[model samples]
Target: MSGDDILELENFLPYRLNRLADAVSRRFAKTYRDLNGLTRPEWRTFATLGQYGSMTASGIGAHSTMHKTKVSRAVAALERRKWLTRTPDPVDRRIEHLRLTKAGIAAYREMVPLARGFETDLLGHLDEQTRRAIVQGLAALEQAADVD
Candidate 1:
């Protein structure tokens, strides 16, 4: 194959998406990290619990697209901070359900506004039509990828 047939790394859709995701994640992480001293995984775990009420670590991992080990460490960190509690599943001896504590809930609530602000700031750079186009394009890409 000629060099003309080779993919350009900078222009590749997957590479661009990954780079954008990383940049956005890091930008948002500053809010939670500065205010709550939470790592990305810990903040994700906490947010998942806050949104879903109660779930197993495996569930959190699936929802967050995080590995099992990352989820475990995040759970442990949140537990240490008294931001989460674990309860044994009634029907499953080995399964433990996790939920956010009152403190965790408070933190999540506080962070929501900050997150919204960050999103607003980022999207503000685009015009209304551009923003809508970007959203529609992302939806189409997700559909094409069979993402849930």
Candidate 2:
């Protein structure tokens, strides 16, 4: 098949989504690592906490679709870095709830603009209507998948 006759991967959803997610993740990981020394899992943990404050480690794992062990390890690493704090749940003394430290909050705040700029650059070429449609479609997919 001639190159001109070939349909490129841009038309395939799974391949395109995986590639896009990996590329974006790698870029974001590098940026965050330089700024805060965060690994991918650690960054995931921080992002989860930044969105949902004070959750049990298990809750984080569930919400992030990560294994409990990975979540626990990331929590420990973040705690050691003073980026997060763990405290016993008042009602469930056996469960430790996680919260972002001041430093963690500040780091998240600093990363937001950079992250937004990166996302904006990625989507900037698309017209507003296409962008909105894409977002709505993705949201619907996530909802259908019960990604809560």
Candidate 3:
């Protein structure tokens, strides 16, 4: 093989991780599109709002692993749909606190079972122990990357 064509698993982590993430996203989008017609960012926004109840845009950004600008855009889209409502933080007018609207909550409730099934199918090959280990390892990698 040419030097340029050499393959090594250790050196391919980033490529593999990106490809896996993309594939999972594509599969999920295909699987869940009919149920809710949710885009990735829209689903992410709903998830963050549902879990945390209420949070500023920066908080959602951190939880969603998305940029502040992306979060802002998503929030705007959700607001336009009336799926979520944003209020100016009383304590800090500059920050907008977001909450899921009743519509958002109902939509989320309806989608939960489908989402769970999608996740379950995605991890069907792995046993619980292996799945936990993989999750822990990925969390460790994310933490390590955050360090200087």
Top candidate when judged by TM-score against the true structure:
1
Give the TM-scores of the predictions, in the order they appear.
0.95, 0.84, 0.81
Clashing pairs in 2: none
> Clashes in candidate 2: how many?
0
Q: Score residue 39 of candidate 1 by CA lDDT.
A: 93
Residue range 29-106, candidate 3, lDDT tens digits: 875467666677777888889888998888887887888778878888888878899889788899988999999888
State the local distance difference test value for candidate 1.
Answer: 0.93
Count of clashes, each model: 0, 0, 0
lDDT of each: 0.93, 0.88, 0.83
Better of 1 and 2 by lDDT: 1
* Model 2 lDDT tens row, 1-148: 8988987888777789889889988987888899888888888899889888788888888887889888888999999989899899889899998999999899888888888888898789899999999899999988987877
Candidate 1 is scored at a TM of: 0.95
Single out the weakest 10-residue window by summed lDDT for candidate 3. 30-39
- Whichever of 2 and 3 has more lDDT, that candidate is 2
lDDT of 1 by residue, 1-148 (tens): 8989999999998999999999999989988899989999998999899889999999999999999999999999999999899999999979999999999898889888888899999999999999999999999999999887
